[model samples]
Target: MGKGGSSKDTYNIAHQKGTPGAGGNRGDRLIKEMIHDPYKTRSKLPEPTVCPECQALFQQGRWAWAEVPPNANQELCPACQRIRDRAPAGFLMLSGAFFQEHREEIINLIRNKEKSEKAQHPLKRIMDIEEQEGETVVTFTEIHLPRGVGEALNRAYEGELDYQYTDETSILRVRWHR
Candidate 1:
C-alpha cells in the first residue's frame, strides 16, 4: 500500500536470499529423492521393438504381449534383461505355520497374481520362487509386482503384510505372515 501500491518487491527481497538458482536445489530444501532402477530404460525404446527372450513387443512406449510384426527390431526388454541378469527388483517373503499348511494354495495364488499382472504389464513378471527352510521367497522382475502380489495375498487370505522400500533404488521387499 506504499508508493506504487505493489508488494512484489517486498516479497522478492524476503525470498531472494535462500532461493534455489538455475540448478534447482539449494541443499537446504528437502527435495524428494528419486529412486532409480538400472534395468529401466532412460529413454523410450523404438516403436515396434521386440524382446528376443520373451517375445514381448514394445509399442506405443510400452511393452505388451503381442504378435511380432515381420522384421520387428529385436532387443531385450527390461524384464527379460533383468531375468537374464538374475537381478530382481522386488522380493516377497512368505512364512508362518499357516503358510506351511496351505503352501500349495498360496503358491497357486501367487502364480495367479503374476499371471494377471503379466497379462496387463509385460514388464512385470516373476523371476523366481524359492522355498527355503522356513519361508518362501518370490522374486519379481519389477518392483510393483511384488507389492501387488503381497497385497493380493493379504486381501485374499487375511495375513500380516509389510513392505520395505529403499531410498537409492527402485526395489521393494514384502513380508507376509498369517
Candidate 2:
C-alpha cells in the first residue's frame, strides 16, 4: 500500500517477528535487574581495605599503610619503621673508661628499673641498650609514666634522663654524666 509491497508486507517488516532486535528490550531488562539486585550474583561480594601489618582496617585518622612486596622482609609497621629508620647511629655513646668501670652496675640498674616499672606500666618495654663513646643509652617503648618513676630513677643513679612521647610511641634517652 505504501510503495512496492502491500500493507501486510510493510507491517511484517516493521514488526519483524523473530528478528534480533526483538530480544534487545529483554536484554536491557535483564541488565536493569542485575544492576538493581547485584547481591543476587555471587561475584558481587564487597572487598575490604585493611592494613597489611596489623590486618586492621583504616577507619579514620592521620595514619599510613605501606604496600609491602610479597615474600619480602615484613618486619615493622609504619610507625616502628619510621622510629627505627630515624634512630641515631651511636644510640648509646659511652666513654671507654666510664663504660668499663660502671658497665655491670648500669646494666643492673636498668634491669631493675625495667622490672619495677613494668609491673605498673604494661605498655612500657625496653627497645635497646647500648654503650657508645661515653654514654649508656637505654631506649624504651613510649608510655605514660607517673612522675614518681622518673624522679626515683634519677635519684637512684644520680644520672640524667630524657624522654620523648608521641600518641603511639615513646623514646626514653637516659645518660649517666660523670
Candidate 3:
C-alpha cells in the first residue's frame, strides 16, 4: 500500500485518464452523442477559426465579421469547409408549375432572405444554386437558411412545404412546391 496522499492521487490520475478530452477517452463515446449543443462557446478552441476561403471569422461562436482580420489565415471555418467539400448542411428544392413561372421572383426572394440572414449571422450562407429542368436546388452552409426559406415560401405563397432532417449527415432537406 502507498501513502494515503499517494493512493488518493493515483485514483484521481487513473479516473482522469478515462475522462473526456483525455488521450485515452475514446472508450466513452456516448458523451459525444448526447451533447451536440452547437450554441456552445468557442473559448475552448486553440485559436478563433477564420476561414481563408470565405474570409469568415468565428467570433463568439458565430461566423460574422465586418472586415477581414489583419491576422487572418487560410484556416477553413466549418462553413467554408463544407462549401469547399461540396457538402451542404441544408438543402432546399423549389419545384412545381408556380415555381417554374415565377423562378426569378422566387430566386430573388431567397437571395434577399439570405442577405438579411447574413447581415445578422454570417455563418448562414448559400453554398450553391443549381437550376434543373423543372426544379431549382439551393445548397446552404447552415441549416437555418433552408428552414427560413421554407417558412417564407409557405407563408407567402401557401406552397406545399416539407422538411426533413437527417442526423446521419447533420443536414436538413427542405422542399417547396406550389
**Number of the top-ranking candidate, with lDDT as the measure:** 1
State the lDDT of candidate 3 residue by residue for 1-178, as single tens digits: 6566687776576566356444555333545454342433444443455766767676655567757667654466667667777878889999999988898998999999999998887778898999866689999988989999889888878879999987656779999998
Q: In candidate 3, residue 48 scores what lDDT?
A: 57
TM-score for each candidate, following the candidate numbering: 0.83, 0.37, 0.70
- Give the range of the ten consecutive residues with the poorest summed lDDT in model 1: 21-30
lDDT string, candidate 1, 106-139, tens digits: 9999999899889989998999989877799999
Once fitted onto the true fold, the runs of candidate 2 whose alpha carbons sit more than 4 angstroms away are: 1-100, 143-150, 159-172
| lDDT on C-alpha atoms for all candidate structures | 0.88, 0.42, 0.77
Q: What TM-score does model 1 achieve against the real structure?
A: 0.83
lDDT over C-alpha atoms for residue 161 of model 1? 97
Clashing pairs in 1: none
Q: What are the per-residue Cα lDDT tens digits for candidate 2 across 110-176?
A: 5676677655543333556665444565554443322333455467655544543332223333334
Positional deviation of 141 in candidate 1, in angstroms?
0.8
Q: What is the lDDT of candidate 1?
A: 0.88
